[model samples]
Target: MSEAAIVIEHVARRFGALEAVRGATLTVERGEIFGLVGPDGAGKTTLMRMLAGVLRPDSGRITLEGIDVAADPERAKTALGYMPQRFGLYEDLTVDENAFFYGELFDVPRAEYRERVTRLLGAAGLAAFGRRLAGQLSGGMKQKLGLVCALIHTPKVLLLDEPTTGVDPVSRRDFWALLYQLREQGVTIVMSTAYMDEAQRCSRLALLHAGEVRECATPAALKRRLPGALLAIAGSDPRAIRDALADAPGVQGTLLMGDRVHVRVDDGGLRGPELEARLAERALAHAPFETVEPGIEDVFVALVGGAA
Candidate 1:
């Protein structure tokens, strides 16, 4: 097995009356992409902040490469790079200038800083825009610049809090490509995201809800954990079919997706005839229903819908 790059043990954090994080525990293995998957207010940010050594956990411990974060935040930080939801980029400064500032802050030697900056900028496709003011760049370019600054000092682990939350789809793809390249170079990444599809891309995932980890495993394993087979019914009004099948026998859960309603049933035997009977009773017999492979979003809904 690969060595663990980060570990959290029964960590909890509170803000006044709110329990932001509760007894969360997980391990991120070296040279892998680990995703913190959850919706807003699911304690992802709180947990990430604790891991980044920015916020002290009220209880429990966090370790980066066997160094206790709370005990020596400075030492822990040296080996880690954290990009919060809102990465601080000086809009007035040019891209090269921003990289220079961060390099200086990290006390990187002048010669090494120049060489690293050139390589990083080239890799990020930002070499052409080195002299462009950050404020003048597009949202995607700005995000890329933020990433460049974070990597200026060559940290071993990278922690990102929803790095692609507001980025365009193309940019999100580009951002993920960059992450995969970093992983190839043996950097452990721990990132939190609300996007279920993005969660599917991670090598391992921790599904969190209401400040607690609901499940943690590889994406395939988590999807397999879903209790039943899923069927997709395409129709004009999914909400109607969902309501009609709410109390149907063998039906576990029904969720509306786009123009289709995903129905979870106890087994494959419940599909054709049994499902048709339920639909016919509600005059939804014409709607097309077929068995479909369950996605990570389906698993997340099945797990969190009840508690929600």
Candidate 2:
């Protein structure tokens, strides 16, 4: 097998004059969960669409395994399974019926289809609800059903575009469990998500903003790359405290977190007495300050501005 399960090189996409994806490039290893992390309108969905052979890029190349997607989309299509952000499943059809319909689309044999459907339904915890109509299921169940439908044919590559956008906490947990199970079976997954926490769960991540990749690395590696030390400051008025520290000398960035203010500064410049003296001079009552490790969310915001 090739070292890369998927390769995107100098890929650019344009709708008229608007460049949705600008020179985007990345590679995914086989059997790994590679993530695209960005906010809405960051062009992740457009990039994923090109990889799935649904849309052609304006320039550059996309190859699944080793075959070029544009050169032979049908071959790429056969090996790829795509779940769009809002997947379409027949509301009137029962769970089993929906699975059967999709299995046939992938041209699975009747015998193999039956076994695959049964296993997928069980794995999604929908075995007992096979007879229930899709419309009657919960939001999470609908999402799982969409996933099972996409997996009916067991394609080598799986593409999911924001698969868990609005799901509840419990449903989100179940959905991630499903991804882990697929990973164990050696299925390579490339997904896009807006949730920072979800990005931490992947083997590696590509942080996209403003239609470009700012950084790509394991979550731990990204955290370790923070530019400076971080300190947590507490005061009687947390919001006021944050405002006071925003433009203070040595403060690089000040972000409010719950009842405390997260202060970023040059390494070794942010100290307890310094922060306390500053706050006290402003006639503010604040508790003792302490340093804390930076989190992915903070790192993401600091590295990629909200505009991106």
Candidate 2 whole-model C-alpha lDDT, 0 to 1: 0.88
Model 2 residue 12 CA deviation in Å: 0.8
lDDT of each: 0.88, 0.88
Candidate 2 per-residue lDDT, tens place, 144-184, comes to 99999999988899999999999988999999999999999
Off-target runs (Cα >4 Å) in candidate 2 are 234-237, 268-272, 283-285, 306-308
Q: Model 1, 302: alpha-carbon shift in Å?
A: 1.5
Residues 1-308, model 1: lDDT tens digits: 34999989999999999999999989889987999988889999999999999999999999998889999999998899889999999999999999999999888899899999999888888999999999999888888888999899999999999998888999988889899999999999999988888999999999999999989999999988998788888877778877887668887888888878888888856565787787787787456678888888889888877511
Query: On a 0 to 100 scale, what is the lDDT of residue 228 in model 1?
Result: 74
Using Cα atoms with residue i matched to residue i, what is each candidate's TM-score against the true structure? 0.96, 0.94
